[model samples]
Target chain A: MTTSSIASPDVDAEHEQNKTPVSFLGPFCTYSHQATLLAFPDTSKWVLEPTSTIKEVFDRVQSGAAPYGVVPFENSTHGVVTFTLDGLADRAGEYPDICVCGEIYLDVHHFLLGRRPPSSSPESEQRSSGRGGEENPKGVPLASLSHIRRVYSHPQAFGQTARFQAKYLQPLGIEFIDVSSTSRAAQLAAADPKGESAAIASELAGREAGLDVLARWVEDREDNTTRFFVIRRKETTEGGYPPPEEEGKRYKSLVSFTVPHRQPGALANVLDCFRRRELNLTSINSLPSLVAPFQYLFFVEFEGGREDDHEGRISGVLEDLEKVAERWRWLGSWRRKR
Target chain B: MTTSSIASPDVDAEHEQNKTPVSFLGPFCTYSHQATLLAFPDTSKWVLEPTSTIKEVFDRVQSGAAPYGVVPFENSTHGVVTFTLDGLADRAGEYPDICVCGEIYLDVHHFLLGRRPPSSSPESEQRSSGRGGEENPKGVPLASLSHIRRVYSHPQAFGQTARFQAKYLQPLGIEFIDVSSTSRAAQLAAADPKGESAAIASELAGREAGLDVLARWVEDREDNTTRFFVIRRKETTEGGYPPPEEEGKRYKSLVSFTVPHRQPGALANVLDCFRRRELNLTSINSLPSLVAPFQYLFFVEFEGGREDDHEGRISGVLEDLEKVAERWRWLGSWRRKR
Candidate 1:
């Protein structure tokens, strides 16, 4: 497979392209796996490696076993997946060859599933019957948020539903339960016949567990989506391939840093460099630097490839910031997501 | 409430000297409520304002409805509670009124609750026989992880148990379920019998539902503990609160800011001011600015009261950082957790 096949017909016609094998964490059923499949669909054409953790996937991609890997970057509800960020930060220096090539957006859905509803009491049966199917004989209706007493879902699902849980369930005396996955939520509801319990999972999971649908799109926002990154190992091009000249081509660079503890205006001084250089930052987030309990590690993704701009301009800014930063790493840049 | 009557002599005597009320998000039985109760036992005298959400608790303290509030800052398993961070960031300008006074650590325990084990099943009989003379049959010991198809707990609890679930249950095809609270996990498990499902919750919650304890401390780490913050809505006095200052007194200041993207060393420049002035930063976290999809708001807590240090030094640092920041706020300063 070549870049020509994947690129848009209207773009530079002679641009050279290469297909790289990609890997991700998966059993073929997870959202991460789905992202991987979506990012690179021709499994047979490009080597597809699936690992068990985000670190393993990164290692594989960095080691060249697979040229690229896909992993979840962050979820709107769950914040950042620290493991992925940490792995990238830890390997940023050694794997100067790696860069985030693209990103994908996935909509998350939580469902409730179970084998059967708990056996109903005589009173429950009469009450449900009178409600004309609006309520389960022993189970609660999927739409009746108030009747729910317990809810089960994966941590990611729970995060996505955080606002909903706070608004409808927490106040209504409902209990939000956490499970390993949405499928597990379905299984638990299926195994029980209780009317007071429900699970947040996927519809497919509900089918697998023989559970009733309790709710759909229970997230705080209707536009619920998770962003994933596609990272590829750095490669040095041979002399035969021609370089393309195009203004539209773009790359994203990532960096991590820790600032001096006693510095009052450390972060501000750092931002000034960007303002003066006219560089556009796409996104930035800081997580607790796992190595130091109270310290922080910032992950920043910005527009423009490092090589596209003046080297002195970037170095000059970095030097000024270094006085206050305990450490810093410039993750390589890559073409914007295709 | 008089400070003299509420101070505890058993622990640190100094912490008792300047005791104050703490509010939290709750309806009396929630985890945050319990955590607050444990951290501050003198409920009769110290005000315990239970609000509907963590934001409410923060607001109540900021508005002076209560002097301080105890809120769940983060979980060992789940990274950050975005809502809490967002709330704190939203009120960054009030830094002079609120500061982190102390931190609390608590262990989490999970349990299973259900109806009396049915005597007809061999598994039920085995569980009953193991009870050692108890009339009620205890929960049946799981034959294997594979026998468990579904599990439930609160979202935070589920995140903490991820390693355990992946190790023992994922291969066996166990699914996780999310619920509002552990207590509700017990209620749902109690209501269901035929399903091969269980709830991950506190033993106290199980006992309340008349369910047998199937497991305890089911998290990956036995030392699993959640840290809570005691934030006061008052500025610290200058000159270190005068002589005869209570022992173990530590001060903290909080701030928020946004900076230009992609400029190298932007953060370093901000830190330079602090390093030149000699202020120690305690903690920092960044949350997505709710108003903008890509922008972020950073929450930083550091040592030294704003008043203790002359306004010139602090304001000078702020002025330098302000050049690169879209907006910034000073939350306030107070003694560290006593």
Candidate 2:
């Protein structure tokens, strides 16, 4: 937001000298990076920083190193990113000020990315020369899929493209290489001297790495997407949580809690609170409580924002949870992106 | 069960000539292979066969190519294995007879595996000759982790050992090579001639590959365990499904279903059926329905099995589900393995 320098003295004064920073989990060309860019498009107004891990993304915002941070929360194909959920739950008390302010829903696309064989290369020479239907952004004909020996991508990427991998690569006994990120995979694939290696990564990453897209839309499902949380440190004051930036936008609230494992119907009771209010729970996920084997820390998202709690329904659910749950936190509401 | 060939003329006759085939997901040394061995300890009575993928494991069992198949159902750390879940849900119609008969819980452990530096190598000479605190199975000291330029592993292995990786390997900016399986990672690590590569795999895999265990139990959590399902084709007769071989045991039932997305409390109502009966839900997970964007297919595990439904509680729940859910499948019960 372009706040008036005269009206906003404290916040604008710091940003007048240096740009406002936004942190994301990245090497570069990763989905988190893309989400960050999408969240803050004004490069002149914002400085984008990439952190090594999801923890660092939270830490940056928590430590006030950055005002905003973006991290992947879930994917349509791969259900949840536990690290992100766990970080949010664990730091609920100590980092109470940091909360998700918005969300980014990105349509994820994985491509078979690799270096194109040079014209003089034998693999190119051995091609059937029948590149009729295929065309890539680089305008170079892709080498035959048979020429590729190994594939590289993050584990989630490998999982997302299971159907494609089984159909095209399994019979050939091609080795699948997993990396930390899709961008890293692209970088590794590009470093292959023989052009025999491929990466399942974003089209942007492949182009940046100077790799060719061997195959497009390689994910198991066409509707593959990742949801990202745009977290910012709320200006907590004696007034409590700040008012919503957009008053009328429909929002989704995320709350994390834990219940005693020995108690039967405890989780169901907590859920029943939402059901009774017709809150419309969108997602429910759990991570190990870490204290015991069967214990879990649960996260659930519902349709209404704190501001939208006109009937005091969200507060009522929290009140019900007080009795059913051991610990809980209202991890701020965000406008729905999808 | 060792049935006399003379008593059982039909089933035991073919098995007498040839051992029953037990299929698993493997390249050897995989957790699935280990589980298969655990499930069928009588080696003479069973022939263990390794399949390339989980789908193949199901295919073999459905085709009767293998009488029993062992597939990983879930992990404490990673939650559900969606591929395994989806396979069960989809095959409910065509492979109605196949159902989960048993479960195996394997404690998962990851090791930092690599080749030791040769005694004559320069790196070994530079070791200060002060190897005291550490010793490996091969009786050779591990070269410093600094010597490892790249680490190979399945993505889940990388995820499981993220704490260790972040503390040590991340600082070195060591490249991660992801493979199809942990066993494959061990194979790749062992092939490193310079001993400059490491793999995060099982101790069995590392030892079988002739690699030294640099570190033991590198998994981030102590309670890391994978749950496997022993699936077998039921012998359906004109009368009905047969009775359980063992009568009174604590059993867990897995059921798969989908509720209409348009309905607000569709999922909560389905869960209410179990809650009202005090049937504790051990786990709940969702996967994209593939039909549309927001639609999901859900899998839930509860405390009771078919025969344990003495009061017809489970059947009553199923009857209730038929009204709430679009489709449902009672995917058999298995004795719980902690």
Candidate 3:
């Protein structure tokens, strides 16, 4: 994490009063928690609150029950989390108070875990078993995969670790069981004293749940990472916005809008606004509008802070969009995650 | 399905001589099948082959074993299918032979299914149960909710029917099980032959699997739909390029490319290429680059047939992009689904 100088005294005071509790999607120890820790490292400063579902995390933040909520927005391999995006769009009209204020990226590492005796530690067993010795090399067989009858994981995890599953589990006729979240899967695996069931979850989750690591880095891709967003109630002029940016810190603004289908170059016209100002875009995604068939709602992220209007160029683009877009929402602006 | 006139007699003759079979992702029946049927309605003319996975469907098409392969591209409720997108990108360098040539859109309707006999059918039972009392006036109790123990469906199906699940299944303490597909779930429920388990699938799947429809239109959104693609090997000029367009059919072309990170507005400049030619975009999505962290590979869809340019305007844009883009692939040009 990069150390930064404080920007405002009032922002510090407000954070102090409400920073004790923060909510995230979890049974416990999920990627959301990993991202929260990445952004707000000091456990002593903030109380970690775990919600049962992603929607609940958003609800807590919208209701002001938690000062901030952390939710997974996108994964490198899986693409965007539609559940979170849907939550953002579907409830926007109803919960106009909530806005995204920060972002964090967490590199994910999946581990295959199973219940085992504490005496046979994963590290010692791996050391004794030897490294790179063919099939059984990297670690002890840990009760051959042939004995494992069931596999538990979040649906996305199953896809990420497809190669591993095909190599080891498929021939054995293992059954995959989908749970609500990875942490929950870990919890379930730990609860089973027998080694018949295994789970694909984070190393932290496996450790916390007292499950032995059967395999490390099982995901197909090495650089598996998930991006998360910190959502909070909108900070109006009365409370001021996110602490003034530290010198040299870059920022990103998120906005969503709909284009009329009848217009010939409506979508292009929107992109032109960003181009004219040389405001580089980070990402752009479109979701089909529920009310209108074939119509879409575009979610866009662009470089530059909300305050980076040297000549009101950024503001000018926003104003231009407001005029032409069928429906528009200035989601929020915050420091871009390094 | 629209009646399309034969554009090329030579192409038709070639298809007639070689069209032994077409492939789709399946375990007998899936949305892919629905799409395949929509695009190729005359089943007797071409044999229908089912592959175990989406990759196999593409593999079959690329290997020339199948004339055409149908796979899902995106869904209105759930964003793009990343697995399919990744497959398209990862194989371009290796294959460079396959190209999408057609498209289809199918409106999805999820039905609740159970194994109750026709006499104790869901429609008759729900009517007498008075669970909601307002919707069903036919008035005959089927099986009680207490008898239902588990619910099964694809993970996305769970989200689509969240409201129905909450109101009916959740209050009854029903267990949710995730299957590979909705059709597979229906098959499982039908195999049970008991009312203890239920599945959320399509009415077609339920009827084919001998399961009773427990409820109709259980999804939260009424306009749920999925878009699919028809893939075939590319035809070079020497090898025969795509056939000339018919008189009235419009087309959409797909292109993907990576931009240099150091450039200020590299991405915007690419979009400008389209804007300048007045070429309208249908969709745009960015996926993170695996090799270069934070860098992105953009998948863009736009209107205009492959041979639309009288002055080669579209080709000019493609050539200009090849000069500036780090990597580019003209994935395909297909008849746009209407």
Candidate 4:
């Protein structure tokens, strides 16, 4: 694996040769959109299509509007985003032609933005605003969780607010609001009364919206990161592993399956198959099987490629899984540009 | 081993027996407070103080103000609430006697609320209160995701809002706000301009707050249940597991451990010990370790009472775990109510 960043022209040429346009959910500034750009900066020409759901990204790709799509797989703060999981499981058939070609790791930064100094920190900005109080009117202290009346942020930011709420807001009476994106949240806070509204967004968004940073690093954990999947409607190359046919490449595969409900040890049984075959499971996510109550669909990514060393074993496992699963899909296997 | 509700009297007796009041996070309406009451209904007689943070709860217990506390452990939709995890992991020494006794499950229901009638249902009591020709005449159509300028909910509710936002609001350019609880969200939404703001909260809360239900079951999945843990400053009951001493009773142990980062087989190694010992693993949750980056803390619930199990085998497994774990805590071994 090369550590050096792959140049955009080279990645564009590769995507052009593959005849695929990567699709992802975005209006150009959302986190997932940014991740897609980061992962495939030079993939021919990129299209920015607004989607109401992550599945829409996949749907557009399956419909051939684009040959590939990008969706958030998981976050360090929140677990798997179920929309991505259910979309893959529901459209398993369409996705078999699509594989997780690569993954992009991006750190999520949450900020508190407002037009005026928050009640918690009244002084520093008051000096600039020319409002002088007898006592130093400190800018509203972001540390005072009680001072926050309403919190605004993207759903992702909302997820990150879990710890802060549990630790601070839940006790204090602060309220949280969800926004389309951190940027939008910042925009709302800027437009609203700064005293009563605060946005949990990105520093860039705060600056862009002319909002001051009231607090930084509001996520429960400091190491907030999100993982994005680069998905393409292509079968695993001749040999299952992400083909190294081109330089600057890394490969990953995405697979989905539904397991029987109320049957004890169903998960264990499937896991046993992997254990018996000595296959390594990288990550496993389960979403409610939308078709019925109690049923679950699992999306699993593992270390080996479907067409490579463990191909036969995976096929055998799939055969066994078929008996228990109502639906299954092999999304794709593709190499990522580093 | 008795499946009996801990009514007020029993709770009183337990408080007398334990000599500590029970403190939780609530104003008697929040789910956590409700869960606390359900877990120990007589808590009112036993200093049922309400505090804001799990840390505060732990502190009250540690300082001898409260003998026990209840906090949310995890939600089926969102993973573990990290504050509770960190409070437990970071202050293990202060809470040495604290152990998980049992679990309570709560289902999450999100509802949209407003002050006006449904726009489509004119001639009905549900009349749009706002200006006509706009998308939302009764305020904005609560269903029009874009018209929603603000969203409010508990942090946990915020966590669950990811799928909702990704599906409805993100593309529509709506924003979400976080409150301390669903009830609070309802309260704020009811008081806000009907068309401009909506909340993701419980139907009951909306009704209590005199708001109309705009939407229900907004969560991505229906089985959105949250599990809470009962913690007390008491050691495991003697002879609480196995054989005649505790016949007809089942026992479960909760344990927390940190696995070495990047170790492929570290988790498998721990599970292998139980596999070899023929111990059944019931439930397992893995969350990012609060103390370190790139590390994981696993909360595992398994069969058997620690005291009744073979001491040598338990010790041996612990010894082996120490090699792979940076820190580990045997949370508790409790006999389950039959």
Find the candidate with the highest lDDT and give its number: 2
Residue B137 lDDT (model 4): 33
Candidate 3, B51-78: lDDT as tens digits: 7667678778777888677888877766
Better of 2 and 3 by DockQ: 2
At residue A208, what lDDT does model 2 achieve?
Answer: 72
Kindly indicate the candidate among 3 and 4 with the higher DockQ. Answer: 3
Lowest lDDT block of 10, candidate 3 chain A? A1-10
Model 2 lDDT tens row, A1-338: 22121111244555644677778988767877777766676565766778877878887888888888888987887667766875776632446677888888888988888755554455433221223243432222245577778888887787778778877887778877667799888888889888889888887777777776677777877788888898888753311212335344777999988876756577777888888888887877776666665567788888988867789988888888888888887888977766
* Per-model TM values vs. the true structure: 0.62, 0.81, 0.79, 0.67
Sorting all predicted structures by TM-score, with the top scorer first, yields: 2, 3, 4, 1
Better of 1 and 2 by TM-score: 2
List interface RMSDs for the candidates, in order. Answer: 4.8, 2.5, 2.5, 4.9
Ranking by lDDT: 2, 3, 4, 1
Cα error of candidate 1 at position B1, Å: 22
DockQ for candidate 3, please give it: 0.27
lDDT of each: 0.58, 0.73, 0.71, 0.59
The DockQ assigned to candidate 4 is 0.11
Q: Report the candidate with higher DockQ, 2 versus 4.
A: 2
